[model samples]
Target: MGNKNISMAVIRRLPKYYRYLADLLAKDIQRISSKELSEIIGFTASQIRQDLNNFGGFGQQGYGYNVEALHREIAKILGLDKKYKAILVGSGNLGQALTNYSGFKNAGFDIMAVFDANPRMIGLKIRDYEIMDSDLIESFVSENNVEIAILCIPKEGAQQVADRLVKSGIKGIWNFAPVDLDVPSSVIVESVNLTESLFTLSYLMKDGEEA
Candidate 1:
């Protein structure tokens, strides 16, 4: 099956595979059987096989999988091989934290600029980037050919900022605004709702206690 046909559940599991494989590689592990991978990743051997098969089975029947090869493949699949020019709006606590994160840059998402509406926050620096006026976002995005936007603004203004980003040719958004964004099908939005995730953890803990 083609990538579009792959289920989200399987796609979600791919990152885990990539991380564990990276860990194995770091430990000087060369190859691992499906059963061994399952034990480490907490997925059943059959499930791991099925998941990898969706992206073309990378493992040999008896030889299992080459850790380095699998890690490289997964990185390519996740688009980590290419660099993306990104702009961050909302340079408050969350936005500043995201800007300070070096991991995104290492993974090919380079945050080129940071923007803020607050006059107090404007002209501030996060890492090497000096916070710019939100008014300049559209121009900056259009001029620089920005591919992605990281939204850490409030929910009330998130949609407005998103509209501006979409109009300026942004293809993807990493939204931390807590509200679901309304964007075109051509534009992909990956949202992170911290409260919702925390609530999920709380639910699981409560369920375990009741059980």
Candidate 2:
């Protein structure tokens, strides 16, 4: 199927499917039918089938999907096998937490360098790499093959830093800043709005109480 044809809703569910499939594989679960998988993930059987079908059908009519095989296919779809060389652009609490997250590597995002504007944080080591000066971002990116940038900087400085990253040849930006960013069409930006998600949870809880 063409990229334009696929709904964002389906795209958003990809990671959930990938994680659940990985869990199944870990448990040595050999195979799973759509209905059984739906029971586990809370999606309907037809919904799961439709989502998987969008990327080319992996399951058969009589038989089910092979857990390992399905997991591998989803991993391929998510580009988990290709470990992307990435840089982190903040050194504060959120930045430090993200730097310590080993799951990013397992999911194919390799954060090689951490950058901060703070002079005090420049020399500090987080995980394996020392935090570098944010001023050096343009030059460092120019010198290295940096594919993705993790934006953990404050909202006030995010746009400027993102501009530098885009100019320095970073194609993807995983933005954790509170404010929304305006980037060019070529540069992909995925914003993780923590506050928005929290508010959404609150709304859901209130709605449940009313129901």
lDDT of 1 by residue, 1-211 (tens): 3499989998888888988998999999999999999999999999999989888889999999999999999998888889999999999889989899999888889999999999998888888998999999999999999999999999999999999999999999999998999999999999999999999999999999999
Candidate 2 Cα lDDT to native: 0.91
lDDT of candidates 1 onward, in order = 0.93, 0.91
Candidate 2 lDDT tens digits, 1-211: 3467889999899899988988888898999999999999999999999999999989998898988888889888777878799999999999999999998887778888999999999899998989999999998887888999999988999999998899999899999999888889999999999999999999999999999
State how far residue 73 of model 1 sits from its true place (Å). 0.8
Candidate 2 residues lying further than 4 Å off, grouped into runs, are 209-211
- Give residue 166's lDDT in candidate 1 (0 to 100): 96
Clashing pairs in 1: none
- Candidate 1 stretches greater than 4 Å from native: none
